[model samples]
Target: MGLGSYLIYIALLMIVPLWAQSKVKNTYKKYAKKATSSFMTGAQVARQILDDNGLYHVKIEETRGMLSDHYDPRKKVVRLSRDNYHGHSMAASAIAAHEVGHAIQDEQAYAFLRFRHSLFPIASLGDKMSIFLIIAGFILGASGLIMAGIVFMGFAVLFQLVTLPVEFDASNRAMAQLVSSGVIRNNEERDTKKVLNAAALTYVAAAMVAVAELIRFVLMFVASDD
Candidate 1:
């Protein structure tokens, strides 16, 4: 397909997830406040989970953007968004704990997470190289350039596949950690699950779409060669 058509397709693929994300974020904001009676700030809950899980080495830091919470495996840090960092709501607590889950995974050397980390460097390289390869390949219409583009896209897809289990396991950890730590009561587990599941859906959807796009690109190049 032409670049114009590709752009349109990408735009369309992006819109549904964006809309879904917005709706889920709103839903979490509405109900997450009512999750548990802990009344602990996000940072405090993060501390509790770290201490409880014996992950004293993992640091909690504030990051820019709303809902940008994540665990950076390279740095062994849990970066929480400003809102999630300091907010005194169930939403904040749950998110903080979720990041802590990654720390625990790192400590335990969880198989999937370790696999994801192993792919990081190549994935980073692939992320940067993919666009350049694709743009250059289109300009030259060279088979070698097209193949390079395909390889780069394949690396990215591999990263996404590895990331799937890491993220889902972290969400699972978050819920279990809360109960084990007494940060959240058993009765309120469902609320925590809802918010985390909603967040997880975004990642799962993105990975699926990435795979689809990569397959499309490969097929296009192959057909052109034929």
Candidate 2:
């Protein structure tokens, strides 16, 4: 790709995530206002699901920040944002269930989630070191260093790719749990799906950006060789 094309690609990398973030936020905001028919809080829903799945040891804690919910596999804890933890809304129920889905995955040793976890250390190191190594390689005119950097970048890209399946499976589990547990009524399932799907888009956008950047880096490296 030419310089102009590269510029456009970079712009897209920036735009796609922003757009996905906006979509999730807007969708969450819309559904957050609409209470579930069950009138159950996010924490309550999560607790019920965890207990039903025999995850009594896994704990749910209230966390600060907007949409900061996550399951810490190391700690065996599901942390929910304050809004979701306390709010009795469709968004809350959906998000809470999604995080608990991860906990269930942990208990079951879900393959993709296990693979992703195993890759996390290398991916974290790659994320931290790749840019600096690549820049240093260019400065020193060292193709070896550049290739090493690209390899590290490749790991990060793989991590993102693996993450896609892990997230989608979690969302699928979340919806099933929601239905089975009666946390969300049949009529409310559609909007709950909207919330989970919007959240899933953010992961899709992240993986796309990572793959695109890796391709751009490889192209730059090959051009330098020429």
Top model number, TM-score: 2
Tell me the whole-model lDDT of each prediction, alpha carbons only. Answer: 0.82, 0.95
Clashing pairs in 1: none
Against the hidden true structure, what lDDT does model 2 obtain?
Answer: 0.95
Going through the candidates in order, what is the number of backbone clashes in each?
A: 0, 0
TM-scores of the models, in the order given: 0.88, 0.98
Model 1: how far residue 13 lies from native, Å: 1.6
For model 1, residues 152-173, the per-residue Cα lDDT tens digits are: 8788889988887888888888
Segments of candidate 2 deviating more than 4 angstroms = none
Model 1 scores worst on lDDT over the 10 consecutive residues at: 27-36
lDDT of 2 by residue, 148-176 (tens): 99999889989999999999999999999
Compute the lDDT of residue 107 as modeled in candidate 1.
92
